[model samples]
Target: MKPLLLLDVDGVLNPMSRPTPDFHRYRCTVGAEVYTVHLNPRHGRRLIDLALATGSELVWATTWEEHANEWIAPRIGLPSLPVIPMRPGEPSEHGEMFKTRHVADYVGGRPFVWFDDQVWAEDEEYLRVHQGLADFLLIHVDPGRGLTSRHLGMAHEWLTLTGFSQGS
Candidate 1:
């Protein structure tokens, strides 16, 4: 099986720190409330292409949940992808990321590369010590800059080295 690409939205694709006209601003109503998301189109294409190149399954690992498919997917030109479910009011201990626990459960021993702006050393340590069946890569994207070409290059290098392809 291919490795999983766990993607977060706000900082990785949206670059929440920077506000510019280049980003698409949209309002979406998931249930009772309307939420606005800022998305960068280029980031979508870059991620999609990277998934194809790496022979990985792209999965939504964001807090946006299914709303990522409804609001952000079309704007970024990505199809509906499986989402990593986050339980309502999930509690996290100190030094742990909000999504880290759910992510660990969702991956379930599958090799995965997680892209997020909020990854910490504790998150890495947690995965390293607890994960036994699969290799894991935690890529921390800068919220101010979002994802760059260098990040894609690094991901490609890792996937290539991990042997997840018919051939390069």
Candidate 2:
């Protein structure tokens, strides 16, 4: 089975600190709030290239959920990817991200790389002790810079060292 690449939207792809988006900027209103995401076309290519190179199946693990496919993916030039179903809200422990608890359920023992700005040490500890995952990379990206070639390079190296062969 192909390894999983769990992607987050806000920080990894749409850097919150980038004032001027290099690609198209989109705005939408959800209930009482207006949300805008700045996307770089290069990031689209880079992410697509990463998947092709590693043969990892990209899955959306953001609050954006299915909306990622409907809205964010198109703007970022990615085709529809599976969205990790949101677990009903959980109160987080200090230093624990809300998403940590659901990861193992979705991963189902498959090796995975989770890219998110919100990853914390507690999440890693929890996974190490509880998840029984054979291989995983919890990549923490800075929201200020989003993802860079350096991050992709690290991913390539991790997969190489872990002996994760491409499936497709």
Candidate 2 lDDT by residue in tens digits, 74-129: 88789999988877578876567878878867888788889999998898887777
Candidates' C-alpha lDDT = 0.82, 0.81
RMSD of each: 2.0, 2.0
Provide the clashing-pair count of each candidate structure: 0, 0
Count of backbone collisions within predicted model 2: 0
Residue by residue across 57-130, what tens digits does model 1's lDDT show? 88999988998898888898899999999875666665778688888888886788888999989888777767
Tell how far residue 112 is off in model 1, in angstroms.
1.0
TM-score of 1: 0.88
List pairs with backbone clashes in candidate 1: none
Model 1: lDDT of residue 51:
86
TM-score of 2: 0.90
Off by over 4 Å in 1: 131-133, 165-167
Clashing pairs in 2: none
